[model samples]
Target: MLVPLPSPPPPASIRTQVEVPLALPDGSTTTARVVTFNGLVDGLEHLAFGLGRYAERHTAVGSSPATPVRLHSECLTGDVFGSQRCDCGAQLRESIVQLATEGGFLLYLRQEGRGIGLYAKLDTYVLQDVGLDTYEANVALGYAVDQRNYTVAAQMLLALGQPRVAMLTNNPDKVAQLRRLGIDVVTQVPTGLHVSDANVRYLAAKARHGDHTLDLAQLTGAGRARPRAAP
Candidate 1:
């Protein structure tokens, strides 16, 4: 059975912030005002990276244009180890670049493996190797297809006084969930597709099972070679 989505959470408060210069994949550096929060509903140590003109946008909350934001879930393998099985790493990189240049917040949620945790994610990989798709593997292990909740994301936004936003993502769930949690998702901006030979099946599974906005023909068509796996 599916878990019920939590009601909109009470506004959280900013706990701390630090100026961190991040090095990107292309040898470019951008300064990020990384923020931590207090009173997030989940109580996980999720982070919010303020990039570009985030300070300016925060002050312009009630103005004509809404802030730009991306709710990125944690994926250790793809994000840290450069795994090619999914687009999480690519999306992270893309989000950093786009938000850094365009001004936004990257809400790094701590829902590893769709909220199942790191070990279960690895177990799912093993099940995938045996012909199970990502969702199937997750269910076979007695987990929901996806167990993430965006209540914390909304709280983070509200705490920052930026309730309205232009959400950047391909997953409709992110939009709907954020809206349900009381964030005004003014517009949905799709991320550029990062397809590769190794991620073809994984991306296809996301589209088929999760309704992520991904083009199947393009994924199945000619693509780049696989990225080198992490050591």
Candidate 2:
């Protein structure tokens, strides 16, 4: 049977441009100068899109048929404050270095707290502290387990006039979502870690229930193997 396709989401209505810089190897970073407003995209942010500037003078790198772009989600606790619970901070910084060297766009999506907002997400953390899994904690706070979406990134990529991309991700869902939405994903690059003591169970909950694709080898990290498989 042929299944009906999903309706395209509504376009975002608000936008603003801001510039940011990226740190390069050899100990320096290039500036974007002005943030290219991706206009407005939906799902993750109320008016979600992205902010980026040019690394090289050319917004779209020529010669390279498939441009490399890093779709980074905004993680307040980890990215900004250096929280050890997750690998977001490491992923973001590493991606910047790599992108700066290769000259690509870092589509920084402002999806804080896994789309649960800042305050409520903190409350979820409290619940997690009391032993509830990440998914359960989110449900307890009336939020979906993993609400981050990449459609906006796809649109932004299109707006940048690129035909295809080499995406950086560990979640298979990200790859599938981009492909299903008509974005060309030439390569899938893994970023960051699998689990930590601070986020071991949280990562397990994600891999099990949230349909995220992360392997245990990334998690076990040279420790005694668990008798069973990772969630």
Candidate 3:
């Protein structure tokens, strides 16, 4: 029997909106609005950035297609401290730079360690050091390989008045989940591989098990590679 999916509840409204100056990597500056939203049910606060009047442009009559959007999950270690254990920091910076010119919104969700939380993520890293892959370590801890849920992301998009988006991501599951949650993902812009010796194996594990679209040879240069810093 076919059962209909229930509609998601109305997304919470923006709690605060403020404009601020943003410096781009290219030595240019632009004004962007930072909007904070609080989840109605979960109470998690998410940040949405309206880059260079992106909200105004998108809300204009006959605006072309959906806006370019990046749904980036928060990674405290990588994003804040520039840890090279994964490509999270690099991807976040890259997204900011690209969105500066492309004019889009970035939803920063607090889904650390793919929704397993920080403590478990650190424990998983220890297991990974002892010869377990990322997914295996999660299962060993009695959690799903990826505990992330995109319902909040979809709701945030709804709140931003962007029902569709050209998503920037390497994970196919993100696109699939957003669509299942009723957001129209018009296109996918791949966040290219940012490989480092500290994260090569980590990225490889994601590609193998997590269905991330990555070209290992291109990333690793076709050999057993030594660790290199992200460019």
lDDT per residue for candidate 3 within 12-70, as digits (tens), equals 67678777777654476777678887664456887888774473434452246778899
Q: For this target, which candidate reaches the highest TM-score against the unseen true structure?
A: 1
Error of 1 at 169 (Å): 0.6
lDDT of 1 by residue, 74-161 (tens): 9999999888888899889888988887788999999999889999999999999999999999999999999887888888888887
Off by over 4 Å in 1: 1-7, 55-62, 225-231
- After superposition, the stretches of candidate 2 with alpha carbons farther than 4 Å from their true spots are 1-28, 43-54, 59-64, 222-231
TM-score of 3: 0.86
Clashing residue pairs in candidate 1 are none
| Of candidates 2 and 1, the better by lDDT | 1
Across 76-121, the per-residue lDDT of candidate 2 in tens digits comes to 8888787877667766767666665555667777777776778887
Candidate ranking (TM-score, best to worst): 1, 3, 2
Q: What is the lDDT of candidate 1?
A: 0.83
Give me the displacement of residue 132 in model 3, in angstroms: 1.1
Screening candidate 2 with a backbone cut-off below 3 angstroms (N, C-alpha, C), the clashing residue pairs are: 18-35
The candidate that achieves the highest lDDT relative to the unseen native structure: 1
